[model samples]
Target: MEKVFKVLIFTDLDGSLLHRDTFKFDEIKDYLKLLISKGIFIIPCTSKTEREILEFNHELGLNLPFICENGAAISGLELLNIDLPKELILSREKDDLLNIFKNKVPINLQNKCKWVFEMDKKKQSLVFGLEDKKLKMALNRKYTIPFIFEGTKNDRNELSRIIKKDNLYLQEGGRVINLTDRVSKAKALRIFVRFFKKNNKNVKTIAVGDNYNDLDMLKTTDFPCLVFNDKFTLDEIPIDNLITTNKPSPEGWADVIKMALVKIDKN
Candidate 1:
């Protein structure tokens, strides 16, 4: 490719671009302002909800594109042109998932772990208490719904088969299988890139993340950076065109990314 002034930096939120929690790094605001001043667009791609994305965007004073629900939705930039819904993993009603694993899945999994649980006993379906880490691990591997099961060794194959047969899309994530009938981040990015290319054909694509969920987006970008955050093991995964950080969180990320972008431009 070619060096250019226009660039799109897509980053994951937790364990990649920010602290483990929602806390912002002290220098993040300044770094973001610097990038904005340079005319480089910074977009957040996260597994969070639309409402959460909107709130953060408002806080950051950015009217840029947002990839929410783990790449299920993409919007904001005029040239981005992609927004897809995620599979609707219903959280209310008698969780068929709970009943499906009644024999082996622990009943106290909810109490013992830091994962989101489905509480469908009320009139509406809703997800509750997703801050637990242990539960997040369990649900990350195998998530089940009334009609689908994911996270086995043959998860992709099974999901593909289900999609062919039932016209459904399976869910995949860092800490849980969402079981949504929506689109994946990789697929969504392609859509965005097509539109982005239509306007700025010379723009450089940069992606930063810290988990398995980010693999697709990382592969799709021109430059892929892995934030050396504590929550993830960056060395365990293999990727091409990756930039590892000396520090963690967005503060560390900001320091390195700024330097790298400057170096790339200098050369």
Candidate 2:
């Protein structure tokens, strides 16, 4: 008899599981809990900082294993197995990466990048669409720097080129771009899948996202799911059996997850 495949859902937070503007998920709260009760794993794999993800889990009342900072680190892995590491740090420190940026990148390109943390609280709230405690959690990052690029397309491209030369990346998001190390959601998911497969032998991954930065993580999964985003389009995505929904998240997240589960059962 063939062994049953353990399903693992690696999901993006903002614009996928949470509403883009409000950042709430009341619609799918019960649905997520139901899935969790069924022994399925819903891992939040996101560009969010560790504190932000922790705040998310706090609301859920579960200490779920998570990959944060666009896969710069994995936390709570030991919950799955005592032998597994409690926390895994996969990327360079945020300050170290910034130091490299300061030394290698040109002054003109650097000036074009507006660091969000340095901004006033009101401006930070405006840019992130988060306020007070949420805003503070979002800014508590260890491996990535969020910034607004106030430069032309050519300048943005030049900055990306220069960052790439130094083994760094400028990940594009909706309103803000992030400076990350070589680490990415895809790379992090790949590592977790490798570790998970050791015991399960047969496992299937479902990745959900709604932004350009999420494309790689989506591509790395057995089931690539896309949520509705007016700001994001799927014209360039070439994955087979890619599930999508017209309804925006958190409804869209439930829609795609249900679709992926059905597809899994049919296979």
Clash count, one per candidate: 7, 0
State in Å the error of residue 44, model 2: 0.2
* Winning model by lDDT: 2
Off by over 4 Å in 2: none
Q: What lDDT score belongs to each candidate, Candidate 1 first?
A: 0.59, 0.91
Candidate 1 residue-wise lDDT, 1-267, digit = tens: 755657778887776766755446555877787887888877787776656666567767776677766665566755244332322232222243344334333344323322243433221122322334422432332223322132455544644464434333445444445544345565666666666677677777778877777887888877788777565675665778677776878776786577558656865
Q: How well is each residue in 28-126 modelled by candidate 2, as lDDT tens digits? A: 989999998998999999989899998999888888899998899998877777778888899999999999999999998899999998899999999
How does residue 43 of candidate 1 score in lDDT? 77
Residue 177 error for model 2, in Å? 0.5
Flag clash pairs in model 1: 87-180, 87-181, 87-182, 92-120, 93-120, 114-132, 114-133
lDDT of 1 at 260: 58
Cα deviation of 181, candidate 1, in Å? 3.3
Best prediction by TM-score: 2
Looking at model 2, residue 121 earns an lDDT score of 94
